[model samples]
Target: MPSSNKNLSVSVIIPVHNGGESFRRCLSSIAAAVPPPHEVIVVADGDTDGSWCVAQEYYTTVLRIPVCSGPAQARNLGARTATGDILFFVDADVTIYPDTIRQVAIAFSCEPEVAAMIGSYDDAPGAKNFLSQYKNLLHHYVHQTACEEASTFWGACGAIRREVFFAVGGFDNRYRRPTIEDIELGYRLKQAGYTIKLCKSLQVKHLKHWGVISLLRADFFYRALPWTELILRDRQPLNDLNLQLLSRLSVISIFALLGAAIASLWWTALLGGVVVFSGVLLVLNAPVYSFFVRQRGWWFALRVIPWHWLYYFYCGLAYAIGTSRHYWRQKKQLAFGN
Candidate 1:
């Protein structure tokens, strides 16, 4: 394997909708990197905000879709036009570190056999608000602790060999919204025997701000529900990312606490069971909570508990709903013989 990335070429592909100031910073970061990308392809997917025009100012090859298409399509279009050894997919809202692309090129150049790799969000998020910090930090913790041999791909900061990407059909365009498109692509890549690495060292800064309603909507609809259906369809276990073993247990504990609360009304003894389940939850997730405390102090960690518990509660509910829908669709398909 070559020691340096001098011979390698990378094409950075960014898919944006209505990219605002954050997108500007992302482009600026690209400009500031030690070694610039071989080419920059920015796909503006039905942007009225003139993000496409801004992309032109940066000397990027800007492509536009008149009607709004999801990131999957946008990325695929960008990939089709790319002419580099590696296709580096970066989300528009994410800003890369000065050495981010260098790290990506190094990963590919040094590990000749690895076909893909993903990076995590930096511990220090761009947004300083409490919820944004907690959410982005949780993401950082998960990716940092996950197996180096990645089980899934993340579009926020991920790269793949160009030939291998097209050979596997790229991101599944059926996913109209941003739902598990990247994860599904990762699964397919693994099925085809391609290796993907979780390069924790190559971190990027997430520029998204989190609000209660937006966060919950994304978790329940865009993530949990679609994810549950995917697992059922593909016979995959809840064994990776946010749906890992510990998260499954946490979801169970949350629902059990709710059940105990309801039962306490009937017998009054189950009230103790509520406390027991809650304690079990706290113990089960002690590592993450401790992580929060270590990173943000006791007051912040304490404040995060109820929100974290609320996360589990909604996860459980979404799983229930997703499972029911999956079975119902299957039943209907069987009844109406095709």
Candidate 2:
């Protein structure tokens, strides 16, 4: 559907923290989008890398937070100062397609019942590498089949009615860290009887720049901790089947390597065969991994595959630790009635 001629004002809120070169590109893309946002709000969270200055050059309204708070807090701060009817939240690392704003506006206008809408990067072509492919496949598999009542919306390109955002009290500032605040907020919105629509047409190009170690560190600190907090607070079991599959894969791979090592003590050929077979299995799964890697090229795939497995392991371990800590803290709080 084409964009309506009616003026649908939208405030684009971008939270930045040492965003560097990517922030400028993100702003440029947003500016290029049709029916541009009424205003762009960049909430700079104690950016020491001169990101705030760069954002100021691109965005007219820049809100600077002295202390480096997480994106959740930064977004809330931006929303507080925004003057538009609709709030479009975009991560500094993501660039929206030219028609994104129009598509988002159309989706909201067409569906009065949808309190918010989420756009995916999976629609973009050329994400072919083992890691990128796997990432893309995961994105498509999870989101393409996502129910309207999903527990979380992708934070990269999500929009919500200003009223609905305020009604839900914005993102929970309690999350103080850069993690699953989006997921928690989505859960809250659903609890309040609001539906979130997934807009496949509103595509954003995500420049995911993570080598293996960096990715693992990110998962441990950002993703895992926030997820743990959410599961504990809501008492929701870790029921995501994908998590189970990862666990199984990690276990199987570890055992397979150990067996191969043991076999090698007696016969070098057996060990070599095991190693080759493992490599072949990973290669066979290359198509699945290509969805994530296609954007970075062959060099990234060569460097990232080994690290990805370790990253997943660290993520799982961190999640377990975080979950345990959360449960203990909750129990203590309940017992003391503080």
Over 4 Å off, model 1: 1-6
Please write out the lDDT profile of model 2 over residues 145-222, one tens digit for every residue.
445445565577899988999998999887776777888888788778888777655667766564446555667787
Tens digit of per-residue lDDT, candidate 1, span 47-140: 9999999999999999999988799999999999999988999999999988877788878988988899999999999989999999999999
Quote model 1's TM-score. Answer: 0.97
**What is the C-alpha local distance difference test score of candidate 2?**
0.72
Worst lDDT run of 10 residues, candidate 1, spans 1-10
